[model samples]
Target: MTSDSAALPGERADFLQTLDTHRGFLRYTVRDLTDEQAARRTTVSELCLGGLIKHVSGVEARWMRFAVGGAPAMEAAEPGGAVAWEERFRMTEGETLAGLLEAYERVAAETDALVVSLPDLDRVQALPVAPWFEPGATWSVRRVLLHVIAETAQHAGHADIIRESLDGAKTMG
Candidate 1:
C-alpha cells in the first residue's frame, strides 16, 4: 500500500523540488556566516540573513497551517502584534544563524511531509484577514504551496543581495 512517506507522485514531487531549490539558494547565501555576520544589516533596509531565514521559516509554517486548516489556524500559529511582526526581520539578542537554520530545516521538513500526505491540493480555505489580502478571498492548498514557493524565492533573492553586500558572496551568478 502507498504511504505518506513513499516517493511523491509527479505534481507533488515537482512542488517539493522547486521549493527545495529556492530554499537552497537562501541557505547557500548564508554559508559559513557567523551569527554576527548573519545578523548584520548590510543595507539601509532592516533585512538580515538570519532574520530572513527565521521569517521565511515562520511564514512557511504559518501558511502550511492555513493550507491544512484555513485562516484561523494560521492566525493561531503566529505570534501576535506589531513588535512580534517586526522581530521577524531582525535578529534579536541571542539569536544565532545556526539556531535559525535548524528551525528552518524543521519547518521545511514539516511542509514537505504535509505536502506528501495531503489528499487534496484543491481543497480551499478562506484567507486570513489582512489589508494585503482581498476581502473574503479563498485559496486552495495548491495556491498556498505556490505562495510558499514564491515567498521563498523572493526572500532568497533578498538574502543574496544582503549576503553579497556583507562580503561579496553571491549564491549564484
Candidate 2:
C-alpha cells in the first residue's frame, strides 16, 4: 500500500485525499516500465512518461512554494519556464522514470506540508505569468490547493492513456 492509503479521514481530509489520489495515479503511470520505455515519446507531442513526472513535480513545488511565500528550488526551462505545459511533457535521455517519480514524491510531500501548515485559506499568493493565466494576479491558498487538485487529476488521466499506449497495462493498481 502507498503512504497516502494510510492517511486517516478528518475535517480536511478531502484536501489530503486529493493529493494522495493524484500521487497514486502518477505513481501507477510509471510502475513496471523499463527506463527506456519510460522515456519513450509515444505521443506526437514528444511527451514521455518520465518528462510528465518531472513536470508535475516542478509544478507542485512551484505552487506550494508560491502559496507559502517561499521561492521554489526547482529550476525552470529557459524559454517556457517550469510547468511549461508544452515542453514539460517531453523527456530528455538523462531523466529516468524512476528518478522523475522520486522527485515527484519529494515535491508532493513538500506541497502537502505547505498545505497543512497554512492557517488561512484566504491568504493571497502570487502566480507567475504563463500563457493560460493572467499576469500578477494573486490567488488564495484554497484556490491554489484546488488548482493543484485539478492540474494533477488532468495529468493523471493523460498519464493513464500514455501508460496504456506503452503496453496493455490497464487498471492502475
lDDT of every predicted structure (CA atoms) = 0.89, 0.70
Q: Least lDDT summed over 10 consecutive residues: which range in candidate 1?
A: 1-10
Query: Residue-wise lDDT of candidate 2 within 1-173, one digit each (tens)?
Result: 23543363453467778777887887887889998887887767576778778777767776776777722322334223434456566666476777778778777776666656567778985566567668777788788778788887887888788888889686365
Output the TM-score of candidate 1: 0.93
Worst 10 residues of 2 by lDDT: 70-79
RMSD of 2: 4.2
- Best candidate per lDDT, number? 1
Error of 2 at 110 (Å): 1.1
Per-model TM-score, in order, reads: 0.93, 0.79
Candidate 1: residue pairs that collide: none
Tens digits of per-residue lDDT for model 1 on 1-173?
12453477688888988998999999999999999999999999999999999999999999999998888888883543334778988888888999889989988889998998898999999998899999999999999999999999999999999999999989988
